[model samples]
Target: MTGTILTEDAGDGVRIVTLNRPHRLNAIVPELLDDLNHALEAADRDPAIRAIVLTGAGRAFCSGDDLKDFGTQAADEPGTRAYIERIQDVTRNLVLGDTPIIGAIRGWAVGGGLEWVINCDFAIAAEGTRFFFPEIAWGVFVTGGVSELLPRLVGLQRARELIMLGERFDAAQAREWGLVYKVVPDATLRDEALNLARRIAALPVGPVRDLRRILARRDALAPAMAAETDATVRGFLDPATAARIGAFK
Candidate 1:
């Protein structure tokens, strides 16, 4: 593990993968996305790794796309498409890979960050963590198959409200909406996630693998991903959206 992604062996066949850009709140840059995708793929192929605890270093799990960095990529169609594809690659690894991932979330999990939270096999959020999707307001679409997954998790009406309104919700609301598996104290979030991963590692590997495969067998996922990529790439290239992103920078 190198660059924006860090890996640690926690013994018992469990590996801890941390998004290491603490200075920027682990915001999604192209490099971060690339490093994360590679890290996930490596873990998935390693038979010695039974479970993965995915977390971020610093005050936030992820602050979403670094609009400043991402905005520059939007200057051209090819850069825009490649960037969105890299984002989708992370989702593919998390949702389709053989290794089970447990998200240890805290602080802000906004936009794409929140989408990754939803992509986790099951996430454990800290009590005060904040989550939201600002994509609609910014003229971009949600990716990571959130369109399909959110509706299934929180019902269609609630999912619409979340993405359309782009409102911020706390861990309690996330739990009520079935977004997170459990909410733990901020101080104990990492420990709890690792303990859970350890337990998962102790389970029978065959059944665990089967369960992961069964749950992720969503036929709608591929189509949703394709649609999202197209929409998001177009959003990035839109003049109005570029202006909005520029103002933020």
Candidate 2:
């Protein structure tokens, strides 16, 4: 399938979904979300596609939500809220899809970008790639399922540190923290990721899909609970405690 936000192709039972918005760091916009959902649904429906790889063009994998698209508007309000919900749904579909996803992260994966990585079944990052969740500093909370996914991947305390401090982690640090499965040199990242995808694609479909479903179901609940906790804390913070505290003079 071809679209502005995504480019997709199937080969040897592997469907590779490339995030196409290099200018925006492949940030999640409405159209991008729609296209991604469509690509994923197509892969899930296709009997031949046994594995999926999600990657971005240009230097960065994804920088986060399209702040340019959202502009300066607050996301908690009704109009923006609906948009956020749709974005979340897109994320949910990616995680819950039958075909397991492997993220080939090259450069920066921040905010919503990190959420995308967290949702994936496996992630491989380039050695110098950076990861962070900066929404707390933006006077908002993570709407892309980070709260739920982070803890499960890296444990509670590490997730809290990343979210609360908005600290950035390098690829090596991320691997140490259990966020990424492997980290390779920048030049070999894509080849490594593709090789991994091919390996997964060669597996038997019945056992592969069953194993994916078992893990996905268990993994799904953590994000949901994390979303609830994040919403509760975010609601109490309103404009956000971190942002408000910074205004003190």
Candidate 3:
């Protein structure tokens, strides 16, 4: 367990990784991302840990990036690239890593938060959980391999509408759109997620891990993640992005 990321052994080879910035609605900041990457790496390397439930500490799973602090990280090109890369690394660890991660999504999962939701092996959203990508409106590009994953999850047309329009969708709609594996009562979200993880952990680890690896197809993601990084960095460095994000603030 760390200040920004909390790790709890849920027994039965399941680990619960909770985003710990509840006061900020678990908003993304550099420190939080760094801690999250390290925590995820540790869990993945541990042989005893068979499944992980990824969630947030408070009202929202993640309210996306801390807008007030976002501009400074992207003040220059190199800085922008590095910051975006760090964000992408979380997705890499979640999707390409050996351990399976199930998202216990609650409340708002906006922008990059939504990207991480998509990155999960599968997600279980709580009732009333809201999701959307506001990057386009803010003149920034979507990251976390959403370009490659979302189109495949939903159809190309639906992906375009969600990304381009930046409209919010509820948990029920997300399930209908195939974004979430299931939706549970908000009260039992974490318990349900942990139960699901326990079920996965009880399975033969070798076959389960093999299935995750085969299905993840790490080889195909290199180009997609690279393209996402390049595009997102460019968006962050754009003058229009500064104006748009500034106005939002």
Candidate 4:
């Protein structure tokens, strides 16, 4: 399935789903977000598809939300809150879904994009991949359970540096933080990620799926995500956030 995003069976129960907006660095627009959720849900529903490899088309895995289109979104607080919920649902699906997902991160993974990396079951990044959590820099709070989940991965201090201070980190640093499972040659990111996904898909689904579910800890994530979403809605409506966004524009 190919539309705003791309999805194709990569054989042996491994599906390859690419974020297809290369011209825009695969930024999250309404179309891309909706398509991504539909693709992930469809893959999970298909019994034949046991695992998924998510990557980008050209450079970035996803830069972030497309700020270019932000001005056109519904201006009211209620309308904006609903849109935020839709974005959070993508992360919810990724966290709770039975099928495991492998992220093939290449270039920039910043802002909302970095949230995906934190939520993926496994992430294989290219040596050249650059990561940053600049939501604070852009005057917005993170929608995903990044506040709660990120600290669990990299300790509270570093999570604050990354998300609160808005620092940029390299793949080597990301590997040290345990966010990336493997850092390979930049040229082979796709092949390496696909190979891992194929290996995962070849394993028996029952134990593999069960292990993933236990690790996901959806019971905790559900409420943490809800809290984050509610906080994000408030940030989205803040006059300071609006001023910063206007300046960015």
How high is the CA lDDT of each candidate model? 0.91, 0.76, 0.91, 0.86
TM-score of each model, paired residue for residue: 0.97, 0.85, 0.97, 0.96
How would you encode candidate 3's per-residue C-alpha lDDT over 12-74 as one tens digit per residue?
999999999999889999999999999999999999999999999989999988998976977
| Tens digits of lDDT, candidate 2, 72-114 | 3344556455556666766667776778888999989988788
Per-prediction count of colliding residue pairs? 0, 1, 0, 0
Candidate 1 lDDT: 0.91
Greater lDDT among 1 and 2 belongs to 1
Against the true structure, candidate 1 reaches a TM-score of: 0.97
Residue pairs with backbone atoms closer than 3 Å in model 4 (clashes)? none
Arrange candidates, best lDDT first: 1, 3, 4, 2
**Which has the better TM-score: candidate 2, or candidate 4?**
4
**Candidate 2 Cα outliers beyond 4 Å, as residue runs:** 72-76, 218-249
Model 1 agreement with the true structure over 1-249: per-residue lDDT tens digits: 358999999999999999999999899998898899999999999999999999999999999988768557787999889889999999999998888899999999999899999999879999989999999998889999998888989999999999999988999999998999999999999899999999998999899888877787668888999999999999988999888877877
lDDT of 3: 0.91
Question: What lDDT score goes with residue 18 in model 3?
Answer: 93
